[model samples]
Target chain A: MAPKTAPSSGTSNSFQSLLKSYIETTSSRLKLIDVFLLFLMLSGIIQFAYCILVTNFPFNAFLAGFGSCVGQFVLTASLRSQVNPANRAEFKDVSPERAFADFALGSIVLHFFVYNFLG
Target chain B: MNLVLRLSSALLAAAVVHAASLSIQNPQFKITAPDASQLRSESLSLAEKPEALSLGPSDVLKLTFQVVESEERKGVQPHQTFLRFYDEATGEEGVQPVRVTPGGKAKFELNMARPPTSLPPTTSDPLKVSLILGSSTHSPVQYELFDLYVPASQPPPAHPDEVAFAPRPEITHTFRPEQRIPAKAVSAFFALFVFWPWIVLLGFWFEIGPRVPHLFSPHILPFTASLAAFEILLFWYWVDLHLGQILLYGGILAVPTALAGKQALAKTSEWRLGRK
Candidate 1:
């Protein structure tokens, strides 16, 4: 029984190793996404700092600053989803053109509301 | 046209009602002479020279006597004595002694005697007058010197009523320093919830499923929706606290921050995804 358990444990370790190798070899957009996420995160942090330091006096400026970044982030994510090969299953019928249109429409609406609120 | 006419008529009616309710009235007053007959009183006015009547050794005393006879006593009674002071410079007369008796009898004495030579007459000085009667040498009566010029006769000055400029009532109000802490804390919390959490979730979503290219990933929408709800709540709370200005300024900050986030995300995404 002990000898049999040893083989199973060894097999489990080999399986984990194989999985790790496969993940390492696979095309990982994680780095790019991380960098993008980091940029956005840093921007949000800086704006938060501005809000704290500047005392939120010019509210429209702050809103415009922050809202545009969020809108861009959403637009970019949508673009990535529409254009990425991995997302073909979900957006198979949705062309990149349509995706771009959606992005544009979403951005327009976001900016419209942002402008109204910024003032 | 109908709506405009209705609105105009409503406004006109309001104006008419307002105008009809307004009224003006002038205040009224009554004037009557004092009942001196029963009181047996007499009154006199005096003029003084040199503007102010002053007493000195050389100043002459002028006396004007008005004695109201009692109702029982007819005419021609004992002599009524009065004292008066005369300003030698302006030739103005002053009532020195005014006497009113219980029977409403009054007398005035003008000092005509030259002031003592020892004391020189002073300019614009007040002259003291005393009326003596009934052999009461110890108790001489005195009266206030009447200003020959009345205040009303003069032209109104620039500040006729100087009392208006007097100090106003002091106001006092108190506020606790800690009262602002809650508002600031709430503002910060909402800011984080509305804007920061999305950035974090973006990072998390990428880490969990690196190959998944869905923008409307199930996770992202909920987080974004939560942020929206939080933002609305904060905005409502801000309005309730009368911190609308603060909220407005916060929104302004949020805009550029959002833009910068988008730029960073796009640049990073393109760099990683190998996209132009």
Candidate 2:
């Protein structure tokens, strides 16, 4: 195994190929969804860090912010998976439109709970 | 009726005879120092008051008197004989009973060092000394004897609970300090910092440029508008609307949204299948 190639360079090359393949194969619609997912993940990380490093004096507001990010990310991820053509065999009965409807309803309900917790 | 009136009149006459007035006689007083030397000796007059008498601390005062009927000069033992000491300025008074023998002779001694509990608390003001005599068969009589000057005494000890009746000191309440908040500048920095993700999200979305050709179609527009309305309703709830009002409005709006979403999704499903 060690004689095959330089280990660090080989690992980096594999990682680069994987990223290139993902960007080339994934659709623009899926990439748009991935961007939203990234935004939610980053927001949650920032909020959690602020609570830990700065102050969670208004703990409810922190919970609301972090929880909304997490909840929206989960709903969006499920919608993405259900709409994904590669997962067609698993979610045969779920149409992309139906998945979007579920996402919209779930997001609205999550937002209501989040805003209630905010105060 | 005539017999009853006659009997009452006779009884009234008997009562009148029995009501002869009583008096005191040979009243004399003397004060002596603790060493047995006499400080004052005087025979009290019946009509006019004598000069005010004063005694020092640790002195002893002795008084002698006899009770008798005014008409019969014979000594008579009265049922009650009292010596009253009254302070005119303070209205404080003390009554001490005097023991009398069968022969109507009474001797009273006031030892200043061992003052009786019945002695009213005294100040520099004088006490008016008097004698009161009462008997069943004779009329009662009171005689003002003389005024006495006693050394000033400390006022009586206050009751243990007396302070409860007095006004008390005002109460002060201490409260905890207000909770601290992060500095405004730091908060503003974080607020702006939090928005960086939005720029990243919009940038990625612009790069992707996902198309939605049917988003404004009649079937999908109502569904999209209703979804936006739901978001607006939730935002309104955060700003001013109560939970109950938001829920009611949400429930009412949900009917149209669900119908529109079903119609839109069904049309999209048809188009997708036809395209495939």
Best prediction by lDDT: 2
**DockQ (CA atoms), all models:** 0.05, 0.54
Whole-model lDDT, candidate 1? 0.47
Query: Candidate 1's error at B75, in angstroms?
Result: 6.8
lDDT of 2 by residue, A1-119 (tens): 66566878789999999989999999888999999999999999988887887778688999999999999999999999999999999998988988998998899889999999988
Off by over 4 Å in 1: A1-35, A53-60, A78-96, A108-119, B1-276
lDDT of 2 by residue, B133-216 (tens): 988778788999999998888886788998899988789998987656888887778878888999999999998888999999
lDDT of 2 at A68: 100
Which residue pairs in candidate 2 have backbone atoms (N, alpha carbon, C) closer than 3 angstroms, thus clashing? none
Candidate 2 chain B has its poorest 10 consecutive residues by lDDT at B177-186
Chain A vs native chain A, TM-score per candidate: 0.59, 0.94
lDDT of 1 by residue, B118-171 (tens): 222334534333333321111222333332211111222346567678886677
Number of colliding residue pairs in each model: 55, 0
Over A1-119, each residue of candidate 1 has an lDDT whose tens digit, in order, gives: 99999999999999999879756863455345445555666676667676785456566767876776777677768776776666779997875545654664476456545655665
